[model samples]
Target: MFFKLQSLALIFLGFNAYASPLAEPNEVHISERGAGLNSFLNLLLSYLPAIDTSVTDATGIITDFDNLLGALTGAQETYNELGRSCTEWTVIFARGTAEPGNVGVLVGPPLFDALDDKFGSSAITIQGVNDYSASVQGYLAGGDSNGSAEMARQIRAAKSQCPHTKLIASGYSQGCQIVHKAIAQLDSATASWISSVLLFGDPLKGQALNSVPSSRVFTACHALDDICKNGILIGPSHLTYAVDVVNAVNFAAAH
Candidate 1:
């Protein structure tokens, strides 16, 4: 949430730098600014191990690799398409605190794009909660009441409108608090409509997600993520959830 100007700029610029050769015009852009050089270095390092071990021919790198990076790139945009029509999946994602747009840039859009690549664009519908302010004050209150209600409203509608769709609830940072609040507001039967839950940098990290079973939920909290820990210490670790996209995607996709 507190991304320094230089760090945020460098994170995306580095991606653009390396990806530019393989990417088309505006093809290698990042949506929202993210945590600075650490995020860039982490992503770079992830590929390094793979490159050293398996990628003998760099030219042989395939579209899947590009697709993965592309998924994490986008413009700050708000979408409210979930439950618009019955589809294979309905994904409702909330952006982190103070993040712009409904879905936010850091994690929501990337997750949407990644899922789209996996199951085709038409196979799923993704929506972000634009009605919520995503304010820090709201997070301190254990999530804004209005935001929680709005998210709950979407959950109710998604299930009623598309009974068979696999409804997934996901959020990052304070967004995770909203998910917990919204689900708690619902009755057991209604809450059970959610197929899976994915949370990153959760403030309520170790706590149960009310009616949602632990088996169906996955919370990605880095050891250094202060938000996920006991005390309040907002470090760069809290903002680097972009690193967990692959694992988050796999968990949501499987369930």
Candidate 2:
């Protein structure tokens, strides 16, 4: 009995050492990071008129939504262009924080390629966030709030339009916060359609983990990546996710 207790105590200590304060959902305060610049900018932006964000289509392309009529027209045009009716594709919406096109160029291609390779066809479309701003302000406020809302709207719209579509939500850094917020707001019916959630270097990893089921969620954080280890401290470590993308693809393929 004493030996058993000793073993258990050692296991507990090991677990604690491996865990970060970020492992606690409520322990890490996102608002407390970085002198409140993000929060202040968010407040300033609140006073301005709202802008149309973006929407995704069956082909996993994200288009700008200029207005109500424009968005509708754009969606229809995209659907038609992609030959929407004949082929079934799994949609993967990927968002990256602070970088203009890093998500598409860096993290998106590998995952998309993997999915295509595994499925033996171009079975996946990656819709990257176009309006993503790489600013400290945007990071704190969860990227663009309007953009995030629009993403949620598009997810619902796509699901309604294509009931057979499979959805995957993915993000990196502050983009993970956007994905988490958007997913949380999804209705049960829409959320149920989500097959997987992939997050890399997520700032709110612990809180985001609780928003979705463990079986459908996968995350990767580099050991030396301060952004994942801490929050939003930029370095070369946080910039790469080649291995993580491979793991994500494997996870998605299995599911």
Compared with the true structure, all predictions reach lDDT values of 0.67, 0.50
- lDDT tens digits by residue: candidate 1, 188-236: 9888778999998888887887688898998988776567863355544
Report backbone clashes per prediction.
1, 1
What candidate 1 gets wrong by more than 4 Å, as runs, is 1-73
Clashing pairs in 2: 98-134
Candidate 2 global CA lDDT score: 0.50
Per-residue error for 241 in candidate 1, Å, reads 1.0
Q: How far in Å is the alpha carbon of 251 misplaced in model 2?
A: 0.7
Q: For model 2, where is the 10-residue window of minimal lDDT? A: 56-65
